[model samples]
Target: MSLVARAKSLANRDALTRVGLALTAAWLLLVLLFWLLGPTGTTEPSGLGRLVRVMGLVLPLALIWVGVSLGRSIEILRAEAADLRQQLGRPLGQDSHGRDAARAPMPAPTARPAAPPHGQAPAPAAAAPSAVAARPRPGDQRQTAMRFEPGQAQAPIDVTTLIRALNFPDGPDDHEAIDALRQALRDPDLSRVLRSAQDVVTLLAGHDVYMDMLPPNPAPAAVWRRFAEGQRGSGVAALGGIHDREALETVAQMMRQDEIFRDTAHHFLRHFDGLLARLVPELDELQIAVLADSRSSRAFMLLGRVAGSFG
Candidate 1:
């Protein structure tokens, strides 16, 4: 069950308990008033006398029932809260995931060092064409400049560097990274690498890797087309059961490191962009609609916004 649903159920149970307690308290109050007034020494039985007698007999039993039910409800809520904490790896009240925490500002790229003064005869430019035909057209030169010879030096693909590059300037590109990671996770060829990773289990657990995080609302045909173009394995279907946020986050982290997912990463990145584009506006509209309603609407609106944003 979702955390919100569990919380709501607990709240309802507590409310029932409270109603029972309130009724008991009111009955006791009436009994106290009757005792002080002595049922107004009159002829027959008065309303106060009947009220006192009934309350004196029934209120204690009702209070006991309320106490027992309240205790049970508190226990259930406590257990649920503990489970939530364990799943999130921290206390619930501490903002364990800190989704609203402001992202650290990105530092600007440092400028390259200036070249030495020209008078010293600039050091020979690193590796250049030995000869340019005097009659060569500008277009020919441009083409030559862009050509890659077979023996030319090339940089190695440093995975760490690449992962870092994938990071956005201001914060982690969670949406983009998730898309790329999903593509990677779905690649059959990367299975061995993923299985071998030291953090694979935690990653999977955290992201609820086995759960389906797919948005439930109908998506544009273009979105499906984009997803289809890069899909590679049946593994994606395994995500249907996941309902935990931490598990989903862990899965995303794993995707970032899995080599199998690299080939289709770009497709996932694009899909992430598409998802954000679609969700943000819908959330804003829903928020506005919710704010126009009652105070209770705030809770529903917040939930809607969270679901929309995450999806």
Candidate 2:
């Protein structure tokens, strides 16, 4: 069945269940009252009284049966609702699914021309350009005909304007600032800058620039190295100074000391550091020393502070 129909059916079933529960509760209450108020002695024990007595003796049993039956019915309805949900591929809750379905895909409207004013003459269609007539047929090999539709010429992008808009260096290491930079770089007008930003972000992401701006866990270093290679091809300088061991060791040590770097260092160590070390062999020994020193220093400092406070 269609989703709407299934939904309506579920609603109807739920309503019926509520009504059934209310009626059952009322019936049970009435039976209990009748049992509490014994039959009047003045009137002959009416057939209704006899019936009530019999029911009073057996009503509890009947109620238990009713409860069991209702429980089973509820379970069945729940299972049915679940099945309907799976079939509809949506959760069973409020009108959320209905609202989502309504919003999912809009219907294509039929085109209707507007009526002209009472006395106005209809506008004439413009003549096709001479270029259209001079164009070779589709099968011709030499034709360089280009189709230019209305409003096809958009404004050209200005790279200098885009660069000015970037306004970088506002807290250079800020994640939000970097994201904005990346976004600005993506503009088609600044394709070159975008490529540069991509390289920079990739390289920076590999490094521990700031604590919160750490790269993805188990960093994709190989992918990053490949990206770096591509960027260097574009003549963008690779980050960091020399590729020598001492330079790398100093850089690593600086990164370890930077408070922000520690926050994301573990992720780098776990994922990308090994791959990066292999590619830039100078970093291998430096990374190990920096990591060990950073951890021990932090541990000792924390211990000393705690001991001083206690003393």
Candidate 3:
């Protein structure tokens, strides 16, 4: 459905919107009475004059309150509608909980007896592959798109496979791999590790080395493990292909040690180290504003606290 209809449906369901509508009606009635029965000329100040005078003093304040309430109600409706859109846009086999109908483990196929000629007994059939097992693996379908779910644990970044893809003759323009990496970046849990590796990949592209050239040397599995563990030194060395060793090391160190890293990691990584330090606090402000309702945001608050404990 269209956003307006979706938003209206949400607003109609909200008690606060009903209250706002009542306040708006009251405000409009006061304005109409003041205009219609107000004293036109000096008549020794009648009862209507006194009533209009009192309403004149209260009308502006009441109108302001009504406006604020309606504005907030509309904003809440818009946010709910946007969330509905996200839910509706999910893939056909996937639900809002991230469960995939097609990803469920399949049972192994059993052998079937074969028909024999005339009255002869039938021979047993050979074992067959399961539905899931019959599906193509990465080796067979390298161009398959990746899926990202923010609430779930991310699969480990496959640097070896990524490097191999980058070294293809048409690697620079390997849209499938690039799209997969981009999709992976949307996972907040994997952003720190994935972004660092992506920086190295972006650097390689700038040096006339499209997917056709190697990254001088493949990073050892130990480096990737240390990266997954949030270690500073090994992670920096693992990304040596970036050319600017000193700069990468500095950013990595700050990201690992800073108190506000969890709150501002996305922004700092997007920009440089010192460019937007003040902006880090803004994330906390936004979290507080959005989490004002304890019931609605308790899970997110708990998750943030747990993630902070890791640091």
Query: Which candidate gets the maximum lDDT versus the true structure?
Result: 3
Q: Give lDDT per model, in order.
A: 0.33, 0.33, 0.35
- For each candidate, give its TM-score against the true structure: 0.25, 0.18, 0.27
Evaluate residue 4 in candidate 3 and report its C-alpha lDDT on the 0 to 100 scale. 57
Candidate 2 accuracy as lDDT = 0.33
Q: Estimate, for each residue in 1-311, the C-alpha lDDT of model 3 and write its tens digit.
A: 33555556566546565676677777779878877998667557789978987897687767767776677767666665564445334322233343332222222323322211111112322332110111111221221122333344456544322222222212223454444445445545344434432332222222222221111222333433343344544243532332334433444554455433333444323332221122123222212221111111111112222233212
> Sorted on lDDT, highest at the top, how do the candidates line up?
3, 1, 2
Q: Residue 142 of candidate 2: its Cα lDDT? A: 16
When sorted by TM-score, best at the front, the candidate numbers are 3, 1, 2
lDDT of 2 by residue, 1-311 (tens): 33555576567666666766676777778877876795747767889988987887677656755765676577555655554443333211113233211111112223223211111112422321110111111211110111111222345423222222222222223344344344444444333333322222222222322111111111122323443243323221222212234324433563456343333333333222232233333222222222212211122112212222112
For model 3, how big is the CA root-mean-square deviation? 20.4
Mind sharing the TM-score for model 2? 0.18
Each prediction's Cα RMSD?
Answer: 22.2, 25.7, 20.4
Highest TM-score against the true fold, candidate: 3
Model 3 — TM-score against the truth?
Answer: 0.27
